[model samples]
Target: MKVRITIMPQAAVLDPAGVATAHALEHLGLHGVSSLRIGKLIELDIEGATEEELHQACRDLLSNPVMEDYCLEVIS
Candidate 1:
């Protein structure tokens, strides 16, 4: 099975990298780009793991509880 994990910054946290990108875009003359947020997308292939197991894996390893969040989707 194929699994996709998306790790994103939590709502209450500050994303400095995203802010920097937005500033850079503005400097480059990209108009009307109000906001930018950066995140990670991880894809993995696993055998003998169910959806629930994958979710646990994300909770344990793919995300930080204090400042990050994650969601996982399974694809055949």
Candidate 2:
């Protein structure tokens, strides 16, 4: 099976990198983008792991629960 994990900062957390990227985009004349966020995408191919295991991996290793949120998807 193929899985995708997306990890991003929580809404209330300040994202310095995202803010910097947004500023850069404005400088390049790409206006009207009010907000931008930086996130991480992790793709994995596994043989027989259950969804629970994958979720545990995400919570423990892939993302910081204190500051980040995550979404897990089964691709195939």
Candidate 3:
């Protein structure tokens, strides 16, 4: 099976990557860009687990619950 996962920093955390990207955009005359956040998109293939089980896997190992949040999707 194929799975897609998205991981992002939590709202309360400061994102240095996002800050730098927004600064660069401003310097490049990209107005109205507002802001941005950097996140990770992970695709993986696994065997011997159900959809719900995969979610648990994400909770247990794929993400840091305190500093980040994650979303899991089954692609195949």
**How do the residues 1-76 of candidate 3 rate in per-residue lDDT, one tens digit apiece?**
8899999989998999999999999999997877699988889999888888978877888888888899988888
lDDT per residue, candidate 1, 1-76, as tens digits?
Answer: 8888999998789999999999999999997887788989999999998788888878888887788899788766
Superposed model 2: Cα runs more than 4 Å off: none
Candidate 1 least-lDDT 10 residues: 67-76
Candidate that scores best on TM-score: 2
Q: Tell me how many clashing residue pairs each candidate has.
A: 0, 0, 0
lDDT of candidate 2 over 27-67, digit per residue (tens) = 99999888999999999999889999999999999999999
- Give candidate 3's error at residue 28 in angstroms: 1.9
Per-residue lDDT of 56 in model 2: 95
- Per-residue lDDT of 19 in model 2: 96
TM-score of 2: 0.97
Under the 3 Å rule for N, CA and C atoms, how many clashes does model 1 have?
A: 0
